[model samples]
Target: MSNRGAGGLLGRRPPEEETGLPKDEIFDLMSNHRRRYTIHHCKQADGPVSLSDLAEQVAAWEKDKSISELGSAERKTVYTSLQQTHLPRLERAGIVTYENGEVELTNQTERLDIYLDIVPENSIPWGVYYLGLSFLSCLVVVGLWMDVLPTGAVPTLVYPTIIIAAFTVSAAYHALANRRYRFENLDEPL
Candidate 1:
């Protein structure tokens, strides 16, 4: 049998539809710094967050100051931008619901997290660290094979075994840490 159409014996259905907004739209929604900040705050919020509070927090971040120290000018500027520009854009993208001076994340919010990986400043990227580890491991293996270093002092497999084990453990720890991010456990202590 060569038939593989919809009515054919295989009867394969269409591909499963994506659950939320399209990826392009999600990226567009996250393209702005203010909108991204709003989503981050909403994710940590216990419930619907007042727009005023959200604006204050965003302003503090922009000014590198504490919320208590945020001037009225800074707060008002951020508040106006959010209300007149960013919030409406986010609302249109279905990523958040804004109403009555309060904003809440919708189901589309979960999609944002996958795109918003916030690495702290002055931190080494994990890929570079892993690559360095791998290079060192390979160098050690080559040295052991060529007897360039002490050949009889230690077992040949020990170096590779330790490197592999370290990589595995590090991967597991990173996964656990990502899964236990602040937004996922607002009620739990870090």
Candidate 2:
């Protein structure tokens, strides 16, 4: 008889407790490649993307072909799947709003960024990289303090300055890479 509402037991937290969609819901939504493509297209678009155009791009990517090379059948198949399954689920999750044959992202779309980490292949994750850098810097400081490093003859201020410089440069590079890898900025005009 408890009126737990749509959230049910899986996520019955009050409004303030919700950051975005629940983690399970997000995983469910992103589990399908089609849905990921749909989100990518919606994010890249400056305005709502028409269903046909979105399907065309998605089909093209799926088939490894250009949009112009996609057959009507391929486009239709994707369009149907998106219209009947993927899009509606996204709409319900508040990740997207679908209406009038067009799709646009909702505020909830931003919440997925943490899950959709944009690390390039062979590149270390930013958090891990930063942690390693901190550890190394700590080790260097310890060495300097113990007079174990070759920098024993170096100025005391040089150690702190070098450590600060390393961090500053890493932060700047991370900022640039963050912009480059952000999904919304892909294929978008500057």
TM-scores, all models, native as reference: 0.67, 0.83
The superposed Cα distance between candidate 2 and the true structure at residue 4, in angstroms, equals 24
State each model's C-alpha RMSD to the native: 6.8, 6.4
* Clash pairs, model 1 backbone: none
Model 1 lowest lDDT segment of ten? 181-190
lDDT of 2 by residue, 1-190 (tens): 7666677665576332464566777777788889988988888779899999999999988998999999999999999999999999998888889999999998777767766656678998888999999999999899887988786477788888989999999999999999887866665211
lDDT tens readout by residue for model 1, 42-100: 88888999999999988987888889998899999999999999999988877789999
RMSD to native, candidate 2:
6.4
Q: What is the lDDT of residue 18 in candidate 1?
A: 36
Could you tell me the lDDT of residue 164 within candidate 2? Answer: 96
